[model samples]
Target: MTSTPPLRQQCPPGACDCHRERLLENPDADLRILLLTRNEEQRLLERLENLKDLADLQRMQQKLQEQLGIRLHIAPGFNEVRTTRGIEFDFEDQPGLCRKTRQAIPAAIRRSMEKNPEIAWRLLDSHDLLGGL
Candidate 1:
């Protein structure tokens, strides 16, 4: 008998990469962004500074998701796609499909820090860029 295909589609490129990296780097941990929102930049920084083990982070993430009814999905192709009409914070990273998706945002951020600080932090963290810190 032939097997049926899975109901869900393959995750976008960067989504899997991010999730894989997180797992490989910390087998049971999650990231801080999963618990915070754009308006909570200060809180996010604080959490990042005090970030502990993976299990702790996982608990924090779970609590935040439960409390806020939101969850952070780490998959390969699912990146925060930015386009002419504002950024789709959860858009998948598809080549040629989203020209502005997953592209650099540091310079744009530097040009106007106040306008994109929170989003910039999210993107910067995702790219594993801590150089400016």
Candidate 2:
């Protein structure tokens, strides 16, 4: 019987190595941004619920895709914005908010929330309660 040689070890380039080292040393060195909008009070709450559900669903979807080599059509919707600073003045327009579909927002939110739950909770908690009509 012939024995095969072990595969050669591969190391990433210098820039990649530097980034990896930095990431390992300081994982939270970078800032993250999150953007959310609500047209109505009820809609905001609904959005938060939807975000949690969507996150769980997508997590399962990703696992299945990786294990079974199956491609799931999650559909394309909304433009998720990412920035170093959370502040962005252009979001005031309805079109910017409207362009984002319900599906995308949850996934985007789930990702952001996972990375930064405190920020997500703070945003969610900021809403005031509405009295019975």
Candidate 3:
């Protein structure tokens, strides 16, 4: 007799229903905190440390719920964007924190700029102002 795969194992529970619900939901209804930065190795560790703080997490959670009308969760993960000189940091959980961190990128860049004045000035000069606009 040939062995057959279990149905439950083959098709997990809530797969169809949950995916359907998520599809029906608004695209922007879910909040995504993306961290786009250059020279990630220098700042990744420090940024992760800041994110692990309790006060920062709480504040971020509150902001997501209040501003985006979506519940937030925080997970630790990062991705590299192709064709770009930067890394995109992604938080699966604590989206609020991610959003806040995204906002703080400029400040962080400024701080880094102070330390490496030469590279900072070069970056500032080379950045495309019109691209963002």
Candidate 4:
């Protein structure tokens, strides 16, 4: 006996489903932008400074996701990875450094990390960045 494949929803014949499908394809499109003002940067750094352990950092990551819709990954001791739409905090070797992959990071984040190397170092240590990735 032959099994049938799962049925898929079909768009109406005359309707243009391209737009709808595109939107559905990338629901996180809106979350692609990471914008933070200087004051906002200061506030975020202050919060990061207060974190006590990996668990606290994880909670902060969740808060960041909920508030800013950005995904934060903390990989200790790994070289920073950046993308056109993503910013990686490089605290492995040099703290408070913003390195880009294809495009430049947002101005605010760049300034924040550049200005607060010690805080960035603290963040790395909190996440055990020095130990391993």
lDDT of 2 by residue, 60-115 (tens): 44653453222344322233323212312122212112223323444444554566
lDDT for model 3, on a 0 to 1 scale?
A: 0.37
Rate residue 27 of model 3 by lDDT: 71
Summarize candidate 3's per-residue lDDT along 1-133 as a digit string, tens digits. 9984221111144332223234325576343322222233235435533443334444645764564333544322234322112322233343223333443443443344345554333332344422443
Misplaced by over 4 Å in model 1 are: 1-41, 75-133
Q: Which stretches of candidate 4 lie over 4 Å from their true place?
A: 1-35, 78-133
Report the error of model 1 at residue 68, Å. 1.5
Of the pair 1 and 4, which is ahead by lDDT? 4
Q: Look at candidate 2 and give me any clashing residue pairs.
A: none
Query: Residue 7 of candidate 4: its Cα lDDT?
Result: 21
Q: What lDDT does the true structure give each of the candidates?
A: 0.37, 0.35, 0.37, 0.43
Off by over 4 Å in 2: 1-101, 128-133
After TM-score superposition, what is the CA distance of residue 77 in candidate 1 from its true location, in Å? 8.2
In model 4, what lDDT does residue 96 have?
Answer: 15
- Tens digits of per-residue lDDT for model 1 on 53-107? 3343346446645653334333213444343123222323222211221222222
Best by TM-score: 4
TM-score for each candidate, following the candidate numbering: 0.26, 0.21, 0.26, 0.36
Better of 3 and 4 by lDDT: 4
What is candidate 4's lDDT per residue for 6-44, written digit by digit as tens? Answer: 322333555422232443367554422223433554577
